[model samples]
Target: MASVFNAVDSISAELATIIQLEAPDEISVTKKDAKIEELMVMDQSLLQCMGVSHASIESILRTTLKYKLAFKLTGARGGGSVLTLLQTLLSATVVDKVTAELESCGFHCLTATIGGQGVQVCFGGSS
Candidate 1:
């Protein structure tokens, strides 16, 4: 939640600049309130196993493909093992980016390790 809030604040700031430049006093700040509400709608779509698998961490890379930031993972695949779809790699990147984002939002991500069970996530935040 803190991550989301922080993202909202940052994005809203950027958008506010654009809005003001385009419309000036023509519109009110009420427009941003809708965006704030939209960001609060959490995207909880996922499965338990995929959350921890190394193969699932490349979601960010997959997103890059769609956005033509395909430029990021430049060059071609040669030798060694075959490449996997961008989707399979997205999970880890998502976790990493979200962790940093949440951290930047003033939240501490509590990670607990369990024998044979793996790392469990404990979500907590401070405003």
Candidate 2:
């Protein structure tokens, strides 16, 4: 499923961040960036082989972190299910901004989170 591909993308992004933090020199940073790009491309190819369209896969792989989080909250289909409902309870302002962005891109952006004190909606009607 797309979730598996998404997980690979997440792991790759986290690894890139870790590498950037720990890299000692410009050469190391360049190498790390190349490796990350290669891995991401391969992951996207695998997703395409598994039936996801190029557009959907690209949107999933190339978007900002907030968009990725929004995808997770809204589900790949962008439907607001019980899981999405629970996630919205712990929302953030970035989620609101990205939700709008995702919507403009034709994906549904739900109000949600991975969990906690629930959403306070301090930043407008982000919830």
Candidate 3:
């Protein structure tokens, strides 16, 4: 269990680094850590609602821990037009990169957009 938490932390750090590297200089990225209690509330019905398959849901449930890492983007310094365009491109790139990294680690990830400038990535499975 402790190891699971450590792995989650490591993955989160790597993801942060990836985002920082990919994001433009004018974009500010903030990371929010999800509570385990929040993760625990995710049940089969909820996953099903998210369009997860039965098999995948079962596998997800069996995992002892789940994690969510949110990346919020705000323009630090940019014109309105340039900021909007940069945010749009960064959002897509972050999602694709994060999804690939998590899936390669055997975790199932769900991405949701937030406030038109942020992405919340929820993931769980065996480490």
Overall lDDT per candidate, in order of appearance: 0.35, 0.48, 0.38
Q: What digit string (tens of lDDT, one per residue) describes model 1 on residues 44-104?
A: 1121112422332245334333432221111133311112222212356665665465456
Off by over 4 Å in 3: 23-127
Cα-based TM-score, every candidate: 0.20, 0.33, 0.23
**Sorted on lDDT, highest at the top, how do the candidates line up?**
2, 3, 1
lDDT of 1 at 56: 24
For candidate 2, give the lDDT. 0.48
Error of 1 at 58 (Å): 27
lDDT of 2 by residue, 7-64 (tens): 6668668755744454466676556555554554555455456655545534644554
Please provide, for model 3 over 1-127, each residue's C-alpha lDDT reduced to its tens digit, 9 standing for 90 to 100: 5655565456556545544453333332321212212222332234344453445334434332232222221223441110011133245655566556546757655544433446666679634
Better-scoring candidate (lDDT), 1 or 3: 3
Which candidate has the top score in TM-score? 2
Q: Which residue segments of model 1 deviate by more than 4 Å? A: 1-90, 113-127
